[model samples]
Target: MSFADLGLSDELLQAVEAAGYTEPTPIQAQAIPPVLMMKDLIGIAQTGTGKTASFVLPMIDILAHGRRRALMPRSLILEPTRELAAQVAENFEKYGKNHDLKMALLIGGVQMGDQIKALSEGVDVLIATPGRLMDLFERGKILLTGCELLVIDEADRMLDMGFIPDIESICAKLPTNRQTMLFSATMPPPIKKLSDKFLSNPKYIEVARPATTNINIVQYKVPVTARKKREMLRHLLRTDNVSTAIVFCNRKTTVRELAKSLKQHGFGAGEIHGDMDQSSRIGELDRFKAGEINILCASDVAARGLDVKGVSHVFNFDTPWHPDDYVHRVGRTGRGGARGRAFTFVTPEDAEAVQNVEKLTGGEIPLFEFSGEQPAEAAEAVEEKPKAQRPRRARKDEGAERAEAAPRQEAKEARSEEPRKERRPRRSQPEPVDDGWNGPVPEFLHVSALV
Candidate 1:
């Protein structure tokens, strides 16, 4: 169905059209109606299904009629990470442009001066990470009493990042009569309990099954040794006609190292992980979205937050440790019904990890066969420096040179040293007498008696 059928405002519809989305995604179509009706909601859909827009669009219209107050926002959206919080903020700006709505973003790793200013000036929509929100709430810089609508985006991610307790705390502060919504790709028991405790008779909308991979994504497992993962990734990148891709590594160090390795091998690549500062991470993402870099090596921090369009491929350089991460990592591609491919590098040790992923997705991923010998350049890329030393003839000549100097050294030593029998022994010192003090007499006391 078209976005018009979803009951969006005319100005919002116009903005959406300008943004180039004609029809609503399944999640958007299903969740928008309930949200506009001001009902609490529990939306479960896999990644890349327009979940952000589903809530952002309706909230703009619902909040348009509300008056904002100083130190209080009319609506609030809680995200798990700074990246996801920033992404949701972008959505609000994009879809809420035509409406008269003031928005503020609250996240860590950035100065709080601007956020405080925004809150003091009053904001209509506040998108924040739980940490930053709790910080401001505790400091009395922001109040949730004026908030008429609340959204908990990426609930499972919040659980993964240990934000559930903070979320519970934030919920306790907000007015109970206000509307609440929870969205996630997966619904674990904790999330279910959270919804039951907070939401009141909310409409449940699920576009896709939990932990399911996107059907638009063509997935394949490449069996390679840990040492050759980068090589296989490089090979696939060259042969598979990759346009824009995200390469996910399980560790932040691997993300940095892999990005550097790819750049050294003449690929336009950038790195983003939790270790990076917020500005640096945003800069890398901006570069990637602007096409200055075609490949982004990232940890799971970017798996859920990135919403760049036309991403043709996703390469899992390391199998995700958590099975849930596998869904989000590959979901970086095949976004918005676009056709995409996902290649996961599976080592012998990753058999169990890959098995868990398959089990979660409920299907066996076909093993991708290498057509021929490994790529020559790829192999060279990961090759260790040669261990061979200088030639044997040079070593032999050096040994002869040492042998010639040995006679001179022995003659010098004979001249410099006295014969062992003529050498005198070192003198032994006498022990001090115990004269009541049990030690040597003090020199100061031996000053001939200052008398």
Candidate 2:
């Protein structure tokens, strides 16, 4: 159905049309009507199902009539991460262009003075991360008393990041009669408890099963050694005509290292992670979205809530630690009605992790082989070779052999000699005690003097 049929205001519809979204996604179709009716909502859908717009549209319409008071926002949106919060803010900007609305983004890694100023000026809409929101609330910089609507996006991620307590505190501060909406790609038990606590007779709308992957994405796993991952990634990028892509790593260090390696290999690459400053992260993302960078290496911090269009591919440079994270990583691509491809790099040790992901997705991901690569033969050859012929000895014998042979014996002895000084004994100090017979002692001394 078209966006107009969803009971959105003309201004919102016009904005949607101007933004080139004529049709509503499945989640949007189900979510918008109930939200526009001012009902509490619990929406469960997979990533890349247009869940962001499902709430963004209705929120813009609902917030259109209200005027914000100083330190009291009309609506509050709680996101899990800075990137996700920024993305939601962008959505509000894009869809609420026709309306005279102001939004303040309160997240970490930036100066809080500006956010405090924005809150003081009375923002119509406030999008903030749970931690930053709680920080401001506790500091008496923002108030939730005037908030008429609340949206908790990516509820599961918030729980995963250990923000449930903060969310609970924030909920307690808000008016109990406010409309609350919670959306998630997956609904674990904690998330359910959260919904049960916050939502009152809510409309439950689920577009798809939890932890589901997009069917349009062709998933594949390329088995390689941990040390050979970069080489294999370089090979894959060189072979595939990757127009634009996101490469997911499990750690921030790996993200930065991989981005550097990719750039050194003459690829247009950038990096984003939780460790980087907010401006740098946003700048990198802007460059990637603008097509200035062909590849972006990032941790799961960039996985959810980012709406970068025209991503032709996704590469899991490191297998996700959690099964749910796999869905978000690949879902970065295959968005906006576009077909995308995702390739995951799995090592021999990651077999169990890969199987768990497959079980979570309820299907086996197709196996892929690099062209002109001889991994099996190489492995077999290494296995067939005699242990004595191997260049590096097994780890079990490494330390023992070193200890026995003592090749660096002289150096070891020299090092030990410098530290032969023993620890000094602590000196005992005398304790003072009160004598009860001070006057008797003075008499005894006088008697001795007389003697």
Candidate 2 per-residue lDDT over residues 21-41, each given as its tens digit: 899989999999999899999
Give per-model CA RMSD.
Answer: 8.0, 10.5
Q: Work out the TM-score per prediction.
A: 0.83, 0.83
Q: In candidate 1, what are the lDDT values of residues 1-451, reduced to their tens digit?
A: 7999889889999999999999988888999999999899999999999999999999988988968889989889999888888888888888888998999999999999999999999999999999989899989899899888999999999999999999999999999899999999999999999999999999999888899999999999877777777777888989888999999998999999999999999999999999999999999999999999999999999999898999999999999999999999999999888999999887768989999999998999986655667665434433444888977763468788899999999999998895656656655544555567866676665343323
- Residue 233 CA displacement from its true place in model 2, Å: 0.4
Question: How well does model 1 score by local distance difference test?
Answer: 0.90
Per-residue lDDT, model 2, residue 385, is 51
Candidate 2 Cα misplacement greater than 4 A, ranges? 370-451
Q: Give candidate 1 misplaced runs (Cα > 4 Å).
A: 372-451
Residue pairs with backbone overlap in model 2: none
Q: After superposition, how far is residue 256 of candidate 1 from its true place, in Å?
A: 1.3
Worst lDDT 10-window in candidate 2: 442-451
Q: Where is the poorest 10-residue window by lDDT in model 1? A: 376-385
